[model samples]
Each structure stands twice: as C-alpha cells, then as structure tokens.
Target: MKIEKRWIISFLIISAAAIAGLFWPEAVETPEILSQFGKTEDIVPADVAWLLTASCLVLLMTPGLSFFYGGMVGKKNVISTMLQSFICLGVVTLLWVIVGFSLAFGDPIGFHIDGRFYSVVGNPFSFAFMDHVGVLPHLKMASTIPFMLFALFQMKFAIITPAIITGSFAERVRFISYLFFICLFTLLIYAPLCHSVWHPNGILGTYFGVKDFAGGTVVHMSAGFAALAGVLVLGKRKNSSHIPTNIPFVLLGTGMLWFGWFGFNAGSALAANGTAAMAFATTTTASAAAMLTWIFFERLNGRKVSALGACVGAVVGLVAITPAAGYVTVPQSIFFGFITAIVSNLVLNAKAMKKIDDTLDVFACHGVGGIMGMILTAIFAQGENASLLHGGWNVFAHHMMALLLVSAFTFFGSIILFRITNAIIPLRVSEASEQLGLDISQHDESLDPNRHVPMTILDLAK
Candidate 1:
C-alpha cells in the first residue's frame, strides 16, 4: 500500500496548521472585558437562539446537496459524488477557521478608484485563526447576536458554495485535485465576491448599494459560473450519458433543501423579527410556484412531468428568490419563481447547453436562476431600497453593473484556479479510472461488493 506523495504533503500542511492554531492565543484573554466586541447587553437571546438553529439548518444543506447530486450520477459514481459534497464540510470549515472567514469578513483592504476607496477584499489577518471573534455583538454586522455565531452561520454558506460546483465535473474529477481547486476557489473567488457584496465596506455593498438579501450572487451565481468553468476545463466525461442511480434520494434531498432554506433566507435577517417572518413566507411561496410551474411548463413542451424536473424547478426558485427574499413582497416572490423556472428550464433544454457536458446542469439551474433573481431584485425591490419599478434608477443601474462584474470574476477566476490546480495535481482522472468508475478507481471502495478493484495508477503504468 504505497501512499501517494500528494497525500503526504497534504497531511503535513494540514497538521502544521492545526498545531499552529493550538498555540494561538484566545481572542479575548479575560471574560470580564468582553466589551471590546460591543455592549454585552445588546446581545438578544432570541436572535442568538434563532441564529444557532439557522446555522445547523444551513449546515444540513451540504449533505442534502450530496444526495441531490449523488442520485443523478451513475451507480458506480454515487459514493464518490456524494463524498465530494460531504468533504467540503470538513475541508472548508478548517480553511474558514484558518483564514477564509478573515478574508471574507475582515477589515477592508482596498485602494482609491475615482476618489472613492473601494474595498475589494477583506484583510486576511483581521480574523486569522478566529482572532477577535468572540461572543459579544459586532456593532454593525449583527448587533443582536454574538460575533462568533454570525461567523459560524456564514461558514455554512461558505461550505455549500464550493460543494455546488462539484456537480459540474462530477464522476470524473480526481478527488485530491478537487480538494486543491476548492481551496483556491474559496480564497480567490468566493472570498472576494463575498466581501464585495456582503461586507459593510465592500464596493458592491456600500458603493453600488447592491442588495443580495441572502446569497443569489455570492453562493448560487458563483457556484454556477465556477461549475461552467469546470466543465470547460475538465471536458466531458468519457461516457457522459447515464440513468440516475436513485430518484428516491433526489426526492429526499429536495425535501431537506426546501426545509432548510427557511433558515437560509430568514436567517439572513440576522434576527428573529418581522423581516425574518416575511423572508420565510417568500421563500416558501417562491419554491411552491417554481415547482408547479416546472411540471406544467414541461407538459406544455409535450414532455412528461417528472419528479426530477419538479425538484430542479423548486431549487431554482429557491436560488432566484434568495436575493429578494427580504426585499420583495410575497406576491412578487411568486413572479420570481415563475419567471426564473421558465428561464432556467429553457436554458436547460437549449441545444448549446446540451453540447457542454455539465454532468448535472448546475449552470442552467443555479447560475441562470441567480442572474434572474439579481435582475428581478433590481426591478422589484421596494421601500427605502426602491428598484426600477419604484423609480430608483440608480440602484437598478448599479445592480446591472454588479451582475456583470460578478459573472466575469467568478467564471474567469475559477478557470484560472482550475488551471493552477491541474498544474499542481491533474484535475481529471485517467481514462482507465473513469472506465473503472471513481468509486473503485479513486477510493478503492464500491457500493457493489462483487465489483473488482483495478490496479493502482502506478501499477497500471508498469
């Protein structure tokens, strides 16, 4: 049993980081002087409790996504596909604790552009090793909850975003190389986009006034575009067409995702208030509308209604409604679901899209859905954040700019990261590995006990 050199190097790097973390000082030396975070009195118990629950709910989504993707791939690839999503839970969490959280939410590091100091990314050392991340409230970000709780909640979002991309190149990606790509994607692409859109001093948030209430842009759009880039870089799998391994798994995953989304959307409010309730309502309404619209739209096209179609439609609606969940009315949410589902469904069926071997149609469903959501958010937002429909042309214009910027950045940045990873460790598995199936070739394990494991790549070379 010869261990690969890459595995040895990866282990050493991870172990070194863990050892360093153990030696790092606590964020706060004294419990009595927690005032550095904010007034302890400002922490609201209800908000804290709700955020804790929401974090757990959001964490569940990654495993749910694993099942959703696992069911869609070939039987031989199911375990490998599922593990890709599950691995992120451990990998991204550790990365986040190290510097991912800091790179996303730390103090602004930017330069002057047209007399405005536009912050593009956060300072990586600001919260490095969870420094200064404690129980007290962050006066600006989420005043009602512990700063650490907010970081943990956001960590769930970070974990799921990269997992979403695994579906695009599923069944063929080398597991170890996939690991490297995710770390790069999170640091270079995800953290920067997250900072630009969600951070208080970020260019898109403060300068452009872009309103992504949840993460249509940060999570879905980034994942979708990155998935597209991955498809381009990895090319098509050797044998692309296959029947799903388990429809029941897909249905179960969909249910879990739908149930967990209430927390994903409502939790964005960072409170247990009227805004949270409204967001919860809109999330439900949008997904319902999308589910019905998907099946009925398929019937209109002379295609039989399918459970898979319904699940995809419902997920699209969730993606489309995410940016507008708190900003738009419940009635408006129905329109978001209806329109987004129609658009993504059309894209999914497009001849051009079919040519691109995106194994799971991640781009059509999530990328297209997210773009529609952002555009609709710019058109339908109300009250103080009035959109195009409400005569706030400025907000609408900025949103359009932000959309283009985000798309280009995520797509191109991902391609670069993929290339870099390939250079370090080949991104695609060998043809033999693909033919044998990743379960047996990559993991040396299989769902079928009777299935034979192939020789190692090194042995095959001889």
Candidate 2:
C-alpha cells in the first residue's frame, strides 16, 4: 500500500524540528530576575515536593478522562474516543515545550492601558524551547518552586483541554483531522486564554480582576465552548443513540479525576500551605454535595437516580468549585456544588440543548458548569478577592465582561479552527466509515474479536 504524501511530510517536519531542538542553547537567567524572587536556595523543599506530586496528579487526569469518555461511547467507538484523549499527552506536550508554553507564560505582548501593561498573550520567543525556564524560581510566576515545574504543571492543563473537546464530536470525527484541530486549538485558543487569565500580568487577571483559582475559564470553559462549536460543525452522529459501553469505566474515571483534582485546584497555590489545604477541602466538599444533589434532582424530575447521573453530577461539582476552591469557605463550596448541579442538569435536559447533538453532553456538563462556577466565584469570593456580596461591584462587572470575552473567543475561535481543519482534511468520517465504527475503521482495531469477521461471512454462516 502506498503511504500518503501528507504523512511523509508530517514525519519529515517533526524529525527536522526534533533535530533542531537538540542544538537549541540553554537559557541563561539574569541576576536581577533571580534576586527579584529569591536565590535557588530559597526554593522550599516542601513546596517542590508538593508541586511535584501535584504535577503527577494533574497528569493522571488525562488518562482518567480517557477512561471516563471511553466508557460513554458505543463499544465500536470506545478506543477511538479514549485515544483522542490519550494522544494529547504526546501532541500537546511537544507543542507546549516548543512554543505553547511561551505563548502562555512568557513576557507580556499586549498594549498598555492607563499606564498598566495588560498582556493579551505571552511572547513566544521569550520561553521558546524552554528558554529561560529552569530550576530557578520565576520572578513573577511561582517563586517557591522551579519555573520548569510550573510550566510542567500547566502543560497537563493544556493537554487535557483539547482532549475534553473530543467528546463533543466523538464517534464521527476523523482522527487525523481531529488531531489537526487540537493542535490549532491548543496553540491559538488554549495558550492565549492561559496567558490572559493565569499569567500574572494577564488581561483578565490584572486588568479585569477575574479570579480563576484554577482553570474554570481557561480549561473547562474553553473546552466547553469549543465542544459546542465542534458539534455544530460535525453535525450529529448517524445513529446518535446507543447504550454506554461501560459504566464501570465512567465511575473509575470519576474517582481518578476527583483524586487528581486536589492537585489541580490546590496545586495552584504553588505551595503546601493553608491555601492548598483549603482548596483540597473545598474540592471534595463540592463534589460530594453535587453527587447527592444530582441523584436527588433526577428523582425529583421523575427519573431514577443512576450511576451515570451521580458521576456526571460529581464531575460538575468539581468543575463548578474549581475556580472558587481556594477563595470560598466550605459552606460556600457546598452551595456552589448544589447550585451548579441543578443548573447544569437543567441545561442538559433543555429542549434547545437537545437539538444540538453534543454527543456526550460536554457543553452542558463542562461548559455550563464552568460558566456557573465563574458566576458564583464572582458573587461569593471573600477577603482581598471580595465580589458582589462583599460590595465589590467593579469586580463583578469585570468578571461579566471577561466571561463574555472568553465565551466569544473560545466559541468563535474554535469554529474557525474547525473550518481550517476541515479544509485540510474532512472532520467527519465518511458515512460508510461511521457505520463500520471509528475503532475499526480508523484504527483497524476492535474490542470484540468477532468484529474482524466479514459481514458476508457471517451472513453466509447464518
């Protein structure tokens, strides 16, 4: 069989880049920057240890997400769905190391407003090929841990965001085309959002005062809106209805995600301190509350409480609480969990949402949950981060503005990326390929051994 020229070209490009990377010079840190934070001796052992553990935990979440999504798709599509998530561990990592990390955490690249420099994105050259990213603490970012560790932790978040979008168009998406879309989404969308919200001098954080303790806006919201755009572009699966391949996998995935989220939320503190402990407590409290609220809410709606409902609710709580985990009290987290579950459930059941054919309810569970999280964070934040209830109208107003900005950027930006990917290669598989199932049609693999038997042979035997 002849190999496609595109595949050969892609191989050559990757090979050239890898070889060039080997010759890239090690970045030198200036004495002024090093003294601004602390010397390498100031790096706390506990902070480094905690951050290292947290980084591992966050990395585990992607595989957990794979299992979580894999069990929800039809058996014929399970491997394809899981692979879509798993592949990010490889693809996004390389992208992040090369330039994605710089675009997210490098020096400010936006214009000055009222004499304050508000960065829209990071300069790609500032940290290209991990330049200036070393074991030394960053002056502005994380001072307690190595700068490289911070980048590594954030890379996991970047990897998982695009993986989350795969669920929206699962089963029908062409794997190669989906790969291209993720590359675009991560570079163009996820990196910029990360720069805007999480970077110290970012536009949303410094200029707008948006308080995303973790990544409610950067990760979940972006994934949710992008997923919505994908559903619109891919259209519905030929047969949209199917029994889940494995409920056990969903439960397992949920458990893993919950366990890892302690790191996802608490680790944002970059220290093993009181803030991290509070974030850990709030994370679990919200998830438990959401789990119970979800099942009971379903019962009230005249639907039986199900394992699936419980899992979805728990995850929604996690999403909702993420932004406020360190900012809110335990009681506030419970409220966050309860209200977010109710709202996301309602959105999931909305007749209008039903028409969109978001295959796995990604927009409803993640997108709506993230939106609720941001809204609630704006209302309930306390202390120096006071919000509406605390008499900070300006904070509330800016959050609303930031919300609109993020929604438009992630949604419309994703649509354009989808179109570009489709132009390069079709986003949806052919109808025949869809009927045959993506696992077999795309990967030439299947869960069932008998799947290899030709239909004609089975018909002849029958």
Please count the clashing residue pairs in each candidate, in the order shown: 0, 0
Model 1: per-residue lDDT, tens digit, 292-410? 99999999999999999999999999999999999999999999999999999999999988888999999999999999999999999987647999888999999999999999999
Number of clashing pairs, model 1? Answer: 0
Worst 10 residues of 1 by lDDT: 453-462
Per-residue C-alpha lDDT of model 2 across residues 361-417, encoded as one tens digit per residue: 999989999999999999999875479999889999999999999999999999999
Provide TM-scores for the models.
0.97, 0.96
Listing every candidate in turn, what is its Cα RMSD in Å to the true structure after a full C-alpha superposition?
Answer: 2.1, 2.8
Residue 244, candidate 2: Cα error in Å is 0.3
Scored by CA lDDT, what does every candidate get? 0.92, 0.91
